[model samples]
Target: MDLGLKGKNAIVTGATRGIGRAIADLLADEGVNVSVCARKADEVAATVSALEAKGVKAFGQVVDIADAAALQGFVRASAEALGGLDILVSNASALVQGARPEDWKAMFEIDILGAVNALDAARPHLEAAAGKTGDAAVVLISSISAAEAAAPSAYGAMKAAQIHFAKGVAREGAPKGLRCNVVSPGTVFFEGGVWGNVKAAMPAFFEQMLKRNPTGRMATPEEIAAATVFLCSPRSAFTTGINMVVDGGISQRANF
Candidate 1:
């Protein structure tokens, strides 16, 4: 299970909690230097400290993903601090599952454009690292909602856009030895996450969703992270331009 991740460096956005945090933690566990960002300053500091405790170089910044300047700044600073970037995980989401204009705007700015800006900033560093290692990856955290049509929401549209965008990035970056892929997780559950709040406020609905999964439960953040970090590893060097669904079979669509 050696992933060839030791000594590599990565940036994971919205990494102070939940799936993003899990991805950063797992990467650090595999000896990858990690730079992470979230909006809260104290949480960022604590996460950075926790990751550093795992014996990998770790950096954190308080960043509002909706702000392109701040998002790009973090990416550039992370690349400088980490010496280079081999992996970039666009894990932030606005979580706006509504049809309003404001909802669409937020999703576009934070979820879609946030990733766009980060990739732009990291492109040079990723290209350089790819030249040396022949393995650089970008894993976008999408959702199964991207393919499923439970309702018309800006969230699903933006998530679908991310998958499409990653496909293009994969094709264009391949010549430079960079791989881009999407990890579409379905109903991942964690404390203070979407499902956790649903369980508290709308028990019946939450139970319905829980029952919908043949596994009798939703995915854990760690499960999604494991898939994501693996795709970002040299172990999956040939994996690109693909949407790897990690939903415990909750998603019925055959990947092929």
Candidate 2:
């Protein structure tokens, strides 16, 4: 299916690895010029090189998403570098699950403010793109934990906050042909990721978690990316203010 993404430009945060990298790769595959940012300079460079090899214009910068000024600067630079921005994917997170004060602070700074800052920086560019093409999109990479609470978790609370933010953005941007949505993944597994670490250090607990999924496995980064990139595409022009869960049936909550 043609995603209608060719010639568009996008910026993705935390694009060096995991789901962020997967989203960037898929956007590039669909002929979108992409600008990516991550904390590691080497990873950012390598990711840019890889994206360029796909025959699309690609740019990357080392950025700390927790720094609002730096992140907003990167977004503006990306729009200028790529000529305009039609898509924005906020995929960076602190991934802090503890109930400590420091953990909450980190999650709020990176997970919540990160998405807010990116959108604030990209709003004008996105609105302009929508004016020309009749569509522009923002996809926030949240988690199914947003709706599930087995304990007090800053991670889950911040994730839930992201959903609320997306909905508001969608409503506000609707008149301008700009859409915002959230992609909430359940237990996504990739090398060096949370689940991967668990699998290596706590095999029994990892196995227990794995068995909870009806699919008998956790989702791959690519799986989550597919859903994300699609939502960012013009193909899903009408899909906005919605949380699309891609959890491989591990999340029991009904989306409706």
The numbered model that scores best in lDDT is: 2
**Candidate 2: what lDDT?**
0.96
List the candidate 1 regions with Cα displacement exceeding 4 Å.
Answer: none
**What tens digits encode model 1's per-residue C-alpha lDDT throughout 22-94?**
9999999999999999999999999999999999999989999988898899999998998999999999999
lDDT of 2 at 43: 97
Location of the lowest summed lDDT over 10 successive residues in candidate 1: 247-256
Candidate 2: tens digits of C-alpha lDDT, residues 187-229: 9899899999999999999999999999999999999999999
**Candidate 2 has which clashing residue pairs, if any?**
none
Best by TM-score: 2
Candidate 1 collision pairs: none
